[model samples]
Target: MNLTTTTRQRWAWAFYDWANSAFITTVMVAFFPIFFRKYWANGLPSEDITLHLGTANALASVSIMLLAPFLGTVADQGGIKKPMMAAFVTLGVCATLGLTLVGESQWQWAMFAFVLAVVGFLGANIFYDSLLVDVAEEKDFNRVSALGYALGYLGGGLLFAVCVLLTLKPEWFGLVDKTAAVRWAFGITAAWWALFSIPLWLWVRERAPAQAVRPSLPVLLRQSVGQLRDTFRHIRQLRVVWLFLLAYWFYIDGVDTVILMSVDYGKALGFADDSLITALLITQFIAFPAALVFGWVGNQWGAKRGILAGLAGYVLITIMASRMENAQEFYLLAGSVGLVQGGVQALSRSLYASLIPAEQAAEFFGFYNMLGKFAAVLGPLLVGWVGVLTGSPRLGLLAVLLLFGLGAWLLWKVPRD
Candidate 1:
């Protein structure tokens, strides 16, 4: 295997981030929630829309959590991560395309489509992340991971900016109306996702397992179970890995929830969707360079310190967000989030990669993502429940600070690998 980094393969791997991020920003973050509230769930209370969003995210995470470990194990064992990645990518792209079919007063279908897209998005990402070991040497993990996220920020942000324009002023694009523009945005997302993914499929070569053998389904299942058991035992033995995951499970929960729920939170507080989109667009652009800078920070200060720095910023941001009284403050908070979000996440991925056994990258990352998805389940439910019960979105936003604080403290104690 070539240990030297190939620029072409590196970029190819990074482009997957570019591919899927459009769906995340445009469909998940920018427009879909607003569309759901105004169209599909029309006349429903704002709280109800929040509940539905939380429920959808939780359900998708639950589904992925249940299936991820087994699938990742099989892929690792069989040297089939790329094929599995292709399958999930196809699933996600199709589901995203399906969003074009959803119409006004069709919240059920919208929910169903969103769930499928999340499932595909998350499932593909597990394999994608695991491939980091395949594409780069151990020392390059931080930079490469950060590069992937940086490109994701750029790609997602660009598409989101265009989508926001189309939705806010369709006439600029010669569209008939905002509804048509929104639907076309879905098409753009699907196309962008598919187009960028081609580079990875064609260029980046997946690292093959040592021995490749075709096994019957029953045998594969048995092997997967045994592998899962051994991995769990190994994790228990590696106290740092276990502790790191526990810490990550907490911090990323806060991060992901903020990403998914921020627009809704801002909107509920009377901020315009256009302003929210513009603010977050700025976030994506800021995050692009910020992620790369964090990679350098991790190298200079250690991944733990870099992560701690980002989490500290998060704690301050979340607290300030809870007390913000106007849109300008919200925009400022959004920029802060951009500066740290990708950096924290990328550094965490590289840190975890360094801790795990490289041979079982796929299976290990599956558990990592499983814990991540499970955290998603809790974070949203926590924020949503508190928001509904307290009738104060500010209080709900405030509750997330606990997660960042706890995660940072736990992370500080971890020894450098």
Candidate 2:
């Protein structure tokens, strides 16, 4: 690729993160979970609400784990990354927009909508992530990956701030109710994602040429299965990489669980919705610059070292969060998360990008994503289980420290190169 072409492709790829982040911010993190628990499932017990949400999320993760590798292989074979991404994004956007129809009386409908939206959101990421190699040289992957994540935070945060303002004062937006305002936010997220996805479809061409031998569906299936088997075999030879992945799996599980569950935990502890929302906003704003700083730091100290430093931050935050006594403290803890969240995650992606073969980027990223999903299941399940056993959410927060500690130990063993 020429200089101009490379620059355009990189920008297009990064913008996908910018585009879909609205859904992640508005629907997944900030508004919908609260909406689901409060209005959609009004009659349910708190435990049941938690369990149902957890189950829905877990199911979505499992579905993505099963499908992502095959989808990657198929995309690689058919040269259809752009189309696959389009299909999944449309599926996600439509499902998100459909949330407008959910009512206080329609819990089941809301649940199904959420499940579909989550599947679409996660499935779309498989193809989106695979486009990284096409966007930048190996030497520049860390910086480019960080740029994408920073844009993601900024874009998501901007939309989330708008949604928060509308949610807090729906009358200003000429909306009759807060619920309606929130519903409109979902619609906006869908539209935002759809519009931003257009550039990549139109401009960014795939780098790796498709194989000449196009197989039948049955043959494709057989080939993908064999590819998966070979992936496992190949991983066995990369012991250092495998170890780092295991470490990443555990630590990222803790990170993901904390992000997803912190709002609910705040609600349970009687913190106002505005307080939690403000904290999330803080994270978004802080993450934008911090991700770039982390990328620069990773380039100097090495990605693994940067990741270890972030893990240390996680351990400290988890301990402090476990002891929080007020909403103010929650905000403080949220600030800590903002400082490290994007940096850690972006560096991790860049590190993996360094280790994997360019040809196998999608297939290996599929494995990476699956393990991350599996970790998602484990972290939440453990937290929920611990909360049930101890009868205290604080104790469950402390339990997350174990993941960080274990991950740090394993990460320390990884070679810095």
Candidate 3:
């Protein structure tokens, strides 16, 4: 591809981050847990609510974790990454739109819709991450990966700001109340996801595989299963990738746990909903600039070192969070999270991209995403079950420190490039 064309494709690929992030920021991170606890499952005990929400997230992660490797293999073999992403994006958008119809005390229906949306959100990412190699040269991975995350932060934050305003000032938008505004936010999220995804579909092009084929679905399934088994053995031989994934599994779990559960944790401590929402909004905007800076950090210091620095920051943040007592402290913690969250995630992706064989990008990234989803499975359940058993959300939050500490130790052992 010519330089002008290649640059356009890279930006187009990055914009998918902008597209899907609205769902994550508006629906998943800020609104869903808040609405689930205060609206849908209003009368339930706090621990029970935590358990239910965690279970929904875990279920979605498990589904994606089980299927990502196989699906990745199929996408690589078929050269159909865009088509696969389209299917999941449709699923996620439709499920998010479904959230608008769920009425009060319908936590089950709410959970059902939330689960499907999460599945769609994460499933699309497997193909999305794999496309990094297609859109940018290997040497540009860190910069390009960070650009996607920075745009994700900006795009997700912008939409989330409007969604937050809709809740805070429903009259301004001609909505009936906060409940009505929340429902409207879900619909808006779906629309934003679909609208921004169009650029990716139209502009970003997938690289044709070396041995592309047009096998029927049944035949593709059979072949992919066999390929997945072989790839499993193949991964074992790639010691650096294997070790790095093990490290990512733990640190990213801590990261995902905090993102998903922080609002609920603040609520359990008696903080108001407005405070929790504002704190989260602060993180999104702060993350926008911080993500870009980390891309530069990855370039100057190396991806592994950049990741290690982020993990150290996370370790400190987690510890401080366990002792946090007020809204001001929550905001401080939120800002700290923003500083490290995107940096860690962006660098890890670029680092892995540098390590994997380009020809197997989809299949290898499938394994990467699988471990990420599996980490999601463990992280939430760990927090949820511990909160239920210990009757202390603080203790549950503190438990995440172990994952970060362990992950950092292992990451240190990986030889730097």
Among these predictions, the greatest lDDT belongs to: 3
Candidate 1: stretches off by over 4 Å: 1-5
Worst 10 residues of 2 by lDDT: 206-215
Clashing pairs in 3: none
User: Which ranges in model 2 have alpha carbons more than 4 Å from their true place?
Assistant: none
Candidate 3 lDDT over 1-417, as tens digits, reads 899999999999999999999998898888999999999999999999999988999999999999899889999888899999999999999999999999999999999999999999999999999999999988899999999999999999999999999999999999889999999999999999999999899999888876656788898888888989989999999888899999988889999999999988988999998899889889999999999999999999899999999999998998899999889999999999999999999999999999998878899999999998898898899999998899999999988988898889889988875
Give a tens-digit lDDT track for model 1, residues 273-296.
Answer: 778887889899999999999999
Per-residue lDDT tens digits of candidate 2, residues 1-417?
689988988888888888988887788877877998889988787766666666777777788878887787777666677788788898999999899988785888987888888889888888778788777777887788888889999999998998898988999989999988989998888899899888888788875535676677787778878888888788778987688788888888888888878887777677889998998998889889999899898888888888888889999999898888897898888889988988888888888878887777777777777777777787777777777778787887788888888888988887765
Cα displacement (Å) at residue 149, model 1: 0.4
Candidate numbers, best TM-score first, in rank order: 3, 1, 2
Candidate 2 or 1, higher TM-score: 1
Q: Sort by lDDT, best first.
A: 3, 1, 2
Q: Between prediction 2 and prediction 3, which has the larger lDDT?
A: 3
Candidate 1 local distance difference test against the native? 0.89
